[model samples]
Target: MKIAIIGTGYVGIVSGTCFSEFGHEVVCIDKDAAKVAALCQGQIPIYEPGLADMVAKNMTGGRLHFTTELSEAVPEADAVFIAVGTPSSRRGDGYADLSYLYQAAKDLAPHLTGYTVVVDKSTVPVGTARQVARVISETNPTADFDMASNPEFLREGAAINDFMRPDRVVIGVENEKAATVLREIYNALYLIETPIVITGIETAELIKYAANAFLAVKISFINEMANICEAVGADAIALAKGIGLDGRIGKKFLHPGPGYGGSCFPKDTVALLRTVQEHGVSARIVEAAVEVNAAQKARMVKKIRDALGGSETGLTIGVLGLTFKPETDDMRESPALTILPALIEKGAKVVAHDPQGMREAAKLLPDSVIYVENPYEVCLGADAIILMTEWNQYRALDFKRVLATMNKPVFVDLRNVYEPNKMRAIGFEYHGNGRGHEKR
Candidate 1:
């Protein structure tokens, strides 16, 4: 199969590279000349584990290509995937801005030379596939193409593995021909007996939003439980483990923390809520999840302030991890972005460290944040240390060193990365989320 991916962002780059690795010819298209030139020189713009090497290998194998011109790849491809961005609207209404998606459809319509599947690989609103089809038909009357909704389910940190070994492959098509083309494109997964869900365009689109919104709700639910545990002197970890073993809850996303934040959850929940409300339906649970997530971040700020003895003024705090999660450099909606600024506003200076996120975090976080090369550097001369993101490096720290360097021996474990009793025994005033009942 010859595939033309219409964007070279995270999703597009990973999908195209994985598809090429699947023994298909893939050409990734981008409007940015510099990005295309960089990709041609094997310089990947985004960071994902094993992505650079995979892209390089596929390019060396002559199975993958990059270009700035759509006409160069679109006409000869069997599938032209519209993997462009559909970020939340700037109007603050929680609606997704689909201008890029619609424009990609219009641009690719004129270059269609044969029967091709115009797959919507971006996470979009329910009726977006239909709108894309309408845009393409209006742009080029003679275009021979069929619209399909094949929304990606890739997690940012583990996108390549997720794409290569997805639990299921969804193909939303109006006819057998379009479905067949997509199945062939994903034949690598098909051979390994991955479940292929066939559905209508709207259902497929809704699936992506629904899955993300549900996961966001789960995270919020656990965070809410964690808050309740803290109030009643209960242990959140024990509670999560108790319920998670019930076979239905199954323990993913049950770990409580500052809140759920990343490229997907924050915007998707709001967008899902907005979509339902626009259709005269109410998604009260999702609305509450959004509210809870915001409140959770605020609660974290309060947690830090309380740990600092009722105020953050004139405090020097050490922060570990800035990205929403580890193994990826995305800081789109990281909880640190919200929590750190509030502390800074209250006259606290923050020194932060993340293995892969400092460069990007420096741009989103306030300039008052001091980025450090080593994790332990954050602990030097600090009033307290907060574990903001649960990166592997922060999992095990030499507490003696931390205790020796800090002006005050206070530790706030936002990710619940440490046991409260053990830290206290080590002579540091430790604060962990929802561990009020731990033996002290």
Candidate 2:
């Protein structure tokens, strides 16, 4: 199948490249000429675990292409996918700003030459497919195309494996014609007995939000549990393991951290709330999840402050990671953003290090925070050390060397990477989330 993906961002580029790997000719189109140029030179815009290598391989194999102009690929393709951004409307609001998706629909509408399936590959609202259909129909009344909704379920770090061998392939199609084309496009997966769920458009759209919201609820529930564990002298890890071994509640997003973030849960939960409100329905569980997530982040700030002996004023703190999670350089809504800024505002000087997030973090974090190349360098002259994001490097740090470099041996493990008893044996005052701490 000849595929044209109308956005070269994370979802678009990864989906397009993976499609090409399935022996389908795919062209990823983006409005940003600089990004397109970089991709053409085998330079990836974002850092995913194995995306660059896969993109480079597929491009070399002459199956994947990148371009800035939509006109160059849209009319020649059998399917066109809209994979643009739909960020939150504002900081506090959860409404999805669908301007980009609508623009993609409008831009590609005029170039629809024949029977083509215009698929919604973005994590859009329930009626977004209908809106895209309306926009395309209003723009080009004579064009014949079928609209399908195919939401992606790719985790950021392990997106490649998720795409190659997914749990299921969902396609919301109105007719057999559209469904057949989508199935043929996913022929490789279909051959491997991947369950292709064909449903109505709205059900497919709702599935993505439902899945994300449920996971968000689970994460918030555990974080809330962690708070309970902290207050009651219990351990979150043991608690999680005890319940996660159950076949029903399988352990996936059970690790309680600085709340859920990074391009999916936060936005999707908010969007789901907005959608529920629009329909005049109650989403109390999701609303509580959102509230718990915010409270968790604030609680982390309080934890750090208390660990500093009541105040963060005039202290040098070492921060381990900046990205939301490990193996990815995405800092959007990272816990460090909230914690560091609050501490900096309270007059604490911070030195931070991450394997890949420093460049992006520097743009968002305040100037009071110093970024260094080496993780241990962040520990130099530090009063306390914070393991913010659990990157691989921070997990196996030499505690003796770390203690030698720091001014005061205050180890605050927000990710709970190291055990409290072990840190005590090593002679450092360690603080862990949800672990019974002797000190503040």
Q: What do the candidate models score in CA lDDT, each in turn?
A: 0.92, 0.91
Q: Which 10-residue window of candidate 1 scores lowest in summed lDDT?
A: 431-440
lDDT for predicted candidate 1 compared with the true structure = 0.92
Highest lDDT model number: 1
* Model 1, span 196-301: residue lDDT tens: 9999999999999899989998999999999999888899999999999989888889999999898889988998888898899998988999999999999999
| TM-score, predicted candidate 1 vs. hidden true structure | 0.99
Clashing pairs in 1: none
Residue range 56-119, candidate 2, lDDT tens digits: 9999999999998888899989999999999888666778989999999999999999999999
- lDDT at position 3, candidate 1: 96
- The per-residue C-alpha lDDT of model 2 at residue 293 equals 95
- Candidate 2 TM-score, true structure as reference: 0.98
lDDT score at residue 227, model 2, on the 0-100 scale: 89
Q: Residue 304 CA error for candidate 1 (Å)?
A: 0.5
